[model samples]
Target chain A: MEKRVLMKGNEAIAEAAIRAGCRYYFGYPITPQTEIMHYMAKRMVEVGGTVIQAESELAAINMVYGAAAAGARAMTSSSSPGISLKQEGFSYIAGAELPAVVANIVRAGPGLGGILPSQGDYFQATKGGGHGDYRNIVLAPASVQELYEMTIEAFNLADRYRMLALILGDGALGQMMEPVVFRDKEPIDLPKKPWAVTGTGGVRPHNTITSIYIKADVLEAFNRKLQAKYAEVSRREVRAECLNCEDADILMVAFGTCSRIGRGIIPIAAAQGVRVGLIRPITLWPFPSDVIARAAAQPSVKAVLTIELSCGQMVEDVRLAVDGMKPIAFLGRSGGNLPTQKEILQKIMKMVGR
Target chain B: MQAVFKRTAGLLNIPTHYCPGCTHGILHRLIAEAMCELDILHRTIGVSSVGCTYNNYEYFACDMVQAAHGRAPAVATGIKRVHPSKSVFTYQGDGDLAAIGTAEIIHAAARGEKISVFFANNAIYGMTSGQMAPTTLIGQVTTTSPFGRDPDAQGHPINVSEMMATLPGAVYVERVSLHDYRHIIQAKKAVRKAFRVQEAGLGFSLVEVLSTCPTNWGMDPPKSMDWVAEVMIQQYPLGLFRDPKLEESK
Candidate 1:
């Protein structure tokens, strides 16, 4: 039986990481996500894990990179600006195929955007925020329970694929308190990382982890191999949830907190005779394109509406997923303001000619 | 004297890709010889930095990781923390270390990360074909500094070892030159000491080796060495700046 407790989303992620065997954490303080660091700092020491308050976002991400290269399950948390500073390290880690978890409790941003809740970084999160041809396994958590669940899965996916895994949340998700069940009380037995730099006791040769390849041909080959791994991930790892889409006329697409809002409006819209259905993407990067296409193919489905807290970032992905089978519309609110149920309801009403 | 100059055991026996008279050959030999003497050949992990020697993992018999340019120190810090028993070191060049990776090295040393950094300061960016480096001396000309390195406009040369020694985290810091036989011998000693400090469980250690780049300096091999000795040494002195062993002795 899983132990159930009332916790904030940020706290659940911190506790779930401990349960998932993350022994090292490096992060700088950032709004809406600072509680995760604070919780880990207190709890990791009790569990004999290491938690460091890094000097800067760059230092924190590099520290995570270091620990990941050493084959330790390490993580960092930040908002938009801090995450931008971490892109260089993230790119390097992805290029090197090092496993690590990054929690982005996203806030609105072009620059120093706001501390309020917003889903403005959909493109940056799913399409690779860093330089180079690489992708992170991006997990979108809608609630506190999902936060706990997704963070643990993020570690597992990162380790299995040897790539960066991201938990993409917003300020609302980070700040919201809800009940969560903690799974696996027993110490997790992580897979033996043979590639890690665990000291050579004269029993084995030394190991080094880096991304620099001088020969252009060799570097190109390395890139191709990484691409192959990504392709494999895409085939095997698409995750999403369809709520009442079977007989629905309008399919509403959203993720993270926006999905929760969209879910809330589903019954209300149904009562108003809108017949709107909701499709929530659990994994944003290995997007559920197949599911979206299937939803779009429905003859009764009028249009695909994508709702987010940004100026239409995920709409492009929704458009790509629908592939012109139906019209795609976007309703966005930016600069830390989350869309209200009424606003989303109005958008759906207007779209369906109600 | 029947071929006393044989390849080290842990080094590949293939011909090096370095240009004729490149100091990388000398530096590689010095590190390999130190590893052999210390009996840590099997337990060493070399983190190769971005530069001409980026693919140095191919040469070293031990396990190797190629770090992003300037991020070797951070990578080494990670490897050392996870496997404290392993001998972890980063081989970095001037551009990779002094310019791009300045924050990483400084923070690693400041945090007292238990790793070693072998800095190859050739004054110019050799791998990029003679661009001006952070350590490029005043009035020295390179591809980017065609009109001579204007000290007034472009900052003065950075003395990395001196800067690092000021940090409380560094347990060993030294600057050595490979411009001559005497300096080369001293340079080897400095490299050995840096490794020993790490082996003894001391904090961050660094050895900045003043080397010659004949191709980038646009001089013959011998003249490059002479230029390094005469001009480079005057700007960047060579000596041990910090040693935890000496502190304990005092």
Candidate 2:
């Protein structure tokens, strides 16, 4: 029987990471994500793992860089401002092709915006906030259960692809309490990291992990290699869910907490004798552009409504996906505020011209 | 015939890209020698810091990872924590460690991270073609400080060895120069001691070697050596600044 318990999303994610064989965690405190670090600090030692309260987010990410290079399952977590501070290290990790798990329990931001829930980091997270050419395997969880499942999946994907896997959450999901079931997962068989810097022992040639290539040809080739990997990921990984789009006049697009609010729209729209559907993007980077495009091409769908906590971010991606085929409307509540189901229903009705 | 003096196997038999008269080669040799003597080269992981020696990973015959600027200490902390029984060390330049990575190095020392740090303080950013570094002397002339470093404009040079010694977590702290053969010998000893301290599970250990940038300094190798002894030593004195083992012995 799988163990079921009531837990906060942040704590559940941390516990799931431990169960997934992550042995080292380095992090600093930030609102909405502090519980992740606190739980790790208390439990990692009991499981024969290590946890460190790094001096800063910069230090925390670099520590993760080190631990990953040393062939350890390592992770770090932070909020908006703190995640911004880790961009440099993220670029380094991606360039070096090291495996790591980075969690951004996002809050509103252009700067030190607020401690409330927001998805304002859409571009920064998907478009590579760090310098150089790189992209993270960004996963968005819409509930505590998804948070636990995605946290484990992130480790597998990171090790499988030898890339940085990011969990993009919001303050709402991070702080919300929910009943979660811990299922026994099959043991993940990760590839042996022969290139790791865990002592050469003179048994083989020395291994080096570096991103610097002074020669233009060499740097270009490295960039091409990264592009090939990303292309493969896009082909194999894009994940999203569609609901009630078989015969609907309007389709709604959202993710994470916003998607939960979007689900409320389906029931409310039905009672009002309206047809509405939703498509939640679970993997935001290798975004489900094809699905959205195809859905928008359907005859019954008149428009696509994108609801987010930011003024407008994912809307651009939605537009890119739809490519002006149908009218794309956007509704967002920024500055750490969340929109209500009534507000969303009202916006849906307005877009449908009800 | 037997070998009287030969290169240690700790270093790969590759011709380094270092400029003539640069001490980076000498520093690499000293570290390689120490690793061979300590017999931990096989179990050692080296973190190479950014700068001229950013690619030192090619020269060392051990598992190596390149770090961004002064994040070497933090990287080393990560490696050491994962493989505690294995030795971990970082090779960083003065500009990388003292200026950009000050927070990383300071906090690593404060946490008493069990790793060895080999800081090469040449007082100028050699890779970027002669910019004034945090360790550049008060009146040291560089591209950025054309009229010589102005105290009013550039502020005073930081004495990292002296500053780092104040941290309780630093178990071994020493500053040696590589201006001449005799000083180079002392530097090798310092490098060995730094690694030995790590071997014994001591806290953070560091050896700050006053290196020379002959190309960036616009001086020949010989003249640069003399300038280091005659001038650089005046602003940055040499000797052991901290050693907890010495304290416990006393």
User: Pick by DockQ: which candidate is best?
Assistant: 2
Model 2 CAPRI rating: high
TM-scores computed on chain B for all candidates:
0.96, 0.97
Worst 10 residues of 2 chain A by lDDT: A182-191
TM-score for each model:
0.95, 0.98
Writing each residue's lDDT as its tens digit, candidate 2 over A1-354 gives 666789999998899899888999999999989999999989898999999898889999999999999998999999999999999999999999999999999999889999999999999999999999999999999989989999999998999888999999999999999989987478756669998888977788888999999899999999999999999999999999999987788999999999998988898899998899999999998999999999989999999999999999999999999999999999999989999998988888888787
Tens-digit lDDT track of model 1 for B202-230: 88999999988899888999999999888
- For B150-185, candidate 2 gives per-residue lDDT tens digits of 999999999999999999999899999999889999
Q: Highest TM-score among the candidates is held by which one?
A: 2
Question: Residue B143 lDDT in model 2?
Answer: 98
True-contact fraction in model 2 equals 0.86
Pairs with backbone N, CA or C atoms under 3 Å apart (clashes), candidate 2: none
Candidate 1 docking band: medium
